[model samples]
Target: MKKPFIFIISVLGVILESCYYDNEVYLYGNGSGAVCDTATVTYSATIAPIMASNCNSCHTASSGNGVITSDYNNLKTIVNNGKLLKSVNWTAGAIQMPLGGQKLPTCTLAKINKWVDNGALNN
Candidate 1:
């Protein structure tokens, strides 16, 4: 009887532990619980590094499908044409980027959009 009771209690404890829920915002936010910082986004600081890490591998001069994003001028072309945001945002009618990979994080997409809205400046 004792052995059976202990086993049942252990199983119930495990089940309850597995059902714990974490708040999405809390899990992804800054220490103070603030969300993404899109306030001062810039090309060289924000957008360029994002592209380098997530896009330039295949979108560079030698390999892109006529879409070289390794430099500001080439990147501006895509930004101007709307392919950059469309692809990264996985919007319809646009080829999803980092092809065969997951969409960029929401914060990253937000920063890119902010940069574009600010004119996709070379700064």
Candidate 2:
């Protein structure tokens, strides 16, 4: 009885140890461990790609809910209106974006915020 109990406890411990979740920052490091690069963020290279991957699927010209985001001009409209940042940040009074999906990662948000703060230029 003692041996069986000890074996079960050992097995449970192993299982629990193996179930550890990987830290997001560590897994998605920005060159260094657990770092996020907010500097050097560009609209074409950084912001546009993030939008294309995450937003454009639903917010495209024809199918969009009156909120086109497939191109820079349309995207700039939302950014200028403060909807893009508010929605993506999941702030109150703004609809959470990528509906039914998890919020954007912290690093991605930081990059976007940096861009927005820098006048949200077409660069």
Candidate 3:
């Protein structure tokens, strides 16, 4: 009887623990219950790194994807035309970015929007 009770309790505890919800912004503290700073979103400082990590892999100049993100000029073309925001934001009729990967974090998306709203500067 003791063994059976202990086993049941352990299984219940495991099930409850597994049901608990957690995510990066919640645990690491950024998008939720923490600051998502978009105050100084610059090309070199902020936007460039984002593109390099998320976009440049497949959109490189040599990749012939017709969207070269490795350089500022090429990137600017899509930025100006609104493709960047649409794709990343996963807005209707726009192709989702990272092409089958998960959408960017909320904080990251906010930073991109901030950069774009600030004239998508080359700085």
Candidate 4:
């Protein structure tokens, strides 16, 4: 009984701890630790860095998931269609992007939301 209980707790612990991630992609890391001020998610300024540092590695113009987020048009298509985030989480957290432990920072997601709210502009 103790073994089962310990195993269950361990699993739950892992699951809980894996709910979020700290470091991955930042829109404009000034090294100033001021990401909160500009998570507006833009193609030229914000989204570029995030997609480049994180998504481009697996989903670029030439390879990976067939994602061409390098340009504003393709990115706009993905974001507007709501497939950008959804595609990354289709595997039930097993493959939640950044290809690692948790997932995107809450702040980063917030920026994306902001961008979405602002009409998913390329600015």
Residue pairs in collision within model 2: none
Candidate 4 local lDDT, 27-76, one digit each (tens): 43434475564433566788788778767776677775655766778888
- Number of the top candidate by TM-score? 3
TM-score of 3: 0.73
Which 10-residue span in candidate 4 carries the lowest summed lDDT?
23-32
CA lDDT, candidate 1, residue 75: 96
Candidate 4: stretches off by over 4 Å: 1-35, 38-41, 88-95, 99-101
For candidate 1, write residues 2-111 as lDDT tens digits.
99999999999999998874643434443454677776788899988999999899988889889988899999999889888899889999899879999888777778
TM-score of candidate 2 to 2 decimals: 0.72
lDDT per residue (tens digit) for residues 4-118 in model 3 = 9999999999999998756433443345667667777899999989989998889997883798877889988999899999999999999999898999988898888878888
TM-scores, all candidates, are: 0.72, 0.72, 0.73, 0.57
What's the residue-level lDDT of 105 in candidate 4?
A: 65
The whole-model C-alpha lDDT of candidate 4 against the native structure comes to 0.66
lDDT (Cα atoms) of all candidates against the true structure: 0.84, 0.85, 0.85, 0.66
Which parts of model 2 have CA positions greater than 4 angstroms off? 1-33
Q: After superposition, how far is residue 88 of candidate 3 from its true place, in Å?
A: 0.4
Stretches > 4 Å off in candidate 1 = 1-34
